[model samples]
Target: MTVQDIRAFNRFYTNVIGALDHRRHLHAPYTLTEARVLYELAHSPRTDAADLRGELSLDSGYLSRILTRFEQDGLVERAPSAQDPRRRRITLTAQGRETAALLAERSDQAVGSLLSAVPAADRARLAEAMRTIREILSAGRPPRGEDIVLREPVAGDLGWIVQRNAALYAAEFGWNTDYEGLVARIVADFAEDHDPHLERVWIAELDGRPVGCVMCVRDEAPATARLRLLLVEPDARGLGAGDRLIGAVVDFARGVGYRDLVLWTNDVLAAARRLYQRHGFVLTAEKPHRSFGKHLTGQDWRLNLTDAQQ
Candidate 1:
């Protein structure tokens, strides 16, 4: 798209979203920037003026004035950080939290009303287009390893896992739909009959979007666990997602008293194999197979948890 196209879209979106309207922000006394600051403080674990300035890209003097106004209005409290008394930490007071919550609810309602105007069939397309725009823009500056979070799967995560794995593998490795079918079956079985005590799935997210996944499941052999469906998106590589997912599985296996953890992967998956080896997994077996419309060597790698515990 041309610069004019982007600028026109931005202008249209700003008007549609009331981005220039300070008075429309929940009919509150605070401005839009103030509401954003309150929201960030409410959601963040650590908050400081420098970090806020960097995040919002605000002029330091302007941000200081806003913070001063917030403090005067009893919407914010600042204190010396316990970890570093030299630095001041900002937090929302009870009144501030209430105000922030109100702003959030109003904002959500406004967006909901806007979206409600669109046909239901087109909402998904709209959302996907927004995601595509974000992904394309963010391709230049990916998140760091520290920003990645590995969490348990929630509703709809299984379907995402299957879709992402299928699309990524097919595009990158020329794998066929059979690979996607395999992922679908594994996910379906896990969702249907997984044992809570011994089986677990982890989804790695960066900036709230899933970029990788892995699962630990009960193996057929006694006291053994199997690692399955370990995958990291191409855009998310080099951020240590694969290593983190493997580590989560290994730690879960050891915590649950499993004797060994095993995983089957193809030799062509060199990056995954490297991560497995670094995590103390030893190659045990390999064989050539024609699957996923390709001739590939399926290999099994095992890690002994008995030694890991010591």
Candidate 2:
């Protein structure tokens, strides 16, 4: 697209979204930037003025003025950071949280109204176009490692795990639908039989999308746990996601009093094997198997957590 075309589209989007309206407010008269700042403070665990300025790309002077207004309005509270006395940590007051919630609700309603105006069949296309635009624009940007998060899986995530694993394995390793069926069954069993205290699954997310997953399940032996379905998306590789997932599983297994952790994988998955080895898992056995439409060498790896700690 040419510069003019992009500029024209930007102008149209700004108008459609009322971005130029400085007086727009969800529950009170506040600028869009103020609403955004409140939203950030409410959601973030801890943040400082410098961090906010960097994240929002705001001028230091402008951000200072906005924060001053917020403080004067009794919408925020600041305290000296424990790590650095000079830096002040910012947090939202009860009033500020209420305002932030209102803003979020109204923002959702606004977007919902806009989408409702579009034809039903075109809505999905529009959403995909937005994702395409974001991906293209962010192609060369350096990833922030801190933005990667490991969270408990919620509704629809199990299905996503199965679909992504199936698609990625098929494309990368020529795996067949049989492997997908196997993943489906594993996920189904986990959903139905998992115990919250002993078994857990974590979904790794980057930019609010599922990029990786790992699960710890009670193994056949009562004191052993099995790590299963470890996967990292192609784009998310080399970003330490695999290491983090494995670390999470190891920590969880140890915390729950598991003496040993084990996993099964095909010999062809060199990257995964390396990850396992790096995390103190030893290759214990291998067997030839004809499965998933291929002759594969099934390998078993084990980690003795008790011995490793000593």
Candidate 3:
């Protein structure tokens, strides 16, 4: 490789975030893989060992040994699966939960502080470059191949949406029961009496499997509509599901005579911000809210629908 290319990679990877990740966040007693396994367990109370095996692509023997160590340390528990006694499920103990949170919080703090130190314009450039790299890698791999078109949610789909929303938020951000319960209430309401004319739910499917979902609800606070329960599966995030979902919501809102749209999102959702901006959503306000065991700075975004997209 060219010297310039090597230097760029060194500056961005080794010299940049790598230092913080290694020095600040990587010093936990657990190995990185073990920490990731703990993270998976911390999110869902009980997850199948086979499921974890597939999710993390860990070898059966190796994973079992790691889990055994965790169990011995009172950090994790293994139980027989109800559906099949031969199968085992793994869960985090109280100590495991606390350890996972501490690790996650430290990682986030280090990354957040480092990113915050960069100038706004440079940060934007860095973000875009990271996204482009993801796109390039995705194009080369094409895990599921091509972009998936999202459709309105159908029967039984709401259940998957709730599961994905809860599991993803919990794993990614340490968001917990409160967030999941709020999503459940919204989904239950829509299932019981869904007004397609007034509200809509959309899901992105790959290989006929739902990977992402977004919903629009009629807002009572004002006459505007609120975009709620927006989520994309981590694997499918960089493939444009977010932008498509937001676009669909905004289009539906305009079609339904709503002149304004609003959404609440944590500041850590960088991709969501880019999508919102592309769809004419502007930051209107900010508030400090603490949920899921940590402080979060949330921003309110507003979109005026009078000037519709072409």
Q: After superposition, how far is residue 1 of candidate 3 from its true place, in Å?
A: 45
Off-target runs (Cα >4 Å) in candidate 1 are: 1-142
Ordering by lDDT: 1, 2, 3
Error of 3 at 109 (Å): 51
Model 3, span 1-310: residue lDDT tens:
5789967887878666568877785537888788878766643222689977877899999999999999998887787875577989666655765677677677668887887889988976887787676667576657542346565555579999888888888888888788888888989998888665578787877645688888898887666899988888877867777776776677567655788999998898887788888778899999998886679998999998886342
Misplaced by over 4 Å in model 3 are 1-146, 308-310
Candidate 2, superposed: residue stretches over 4 Å from native: 1-140
Steric overlap count per candidate: 0, 0, 0
* Per-model CA lDDT versus the true structure: 0.82, 0.80, 0.76
lDDT of 3: 0.76
When summed lDDT is taken over every stretch of 10 residues in candidate 2, the lowest stretch is 19-28
TM-score winner between 2 and 3, please give it: 2
Lowest-scoring 10 consecutive residues by lDDT in candidate 1? 19-28
Q: Which candidate leads in TM-score? A: 2
lDDT computed for candidate 2: 0.80
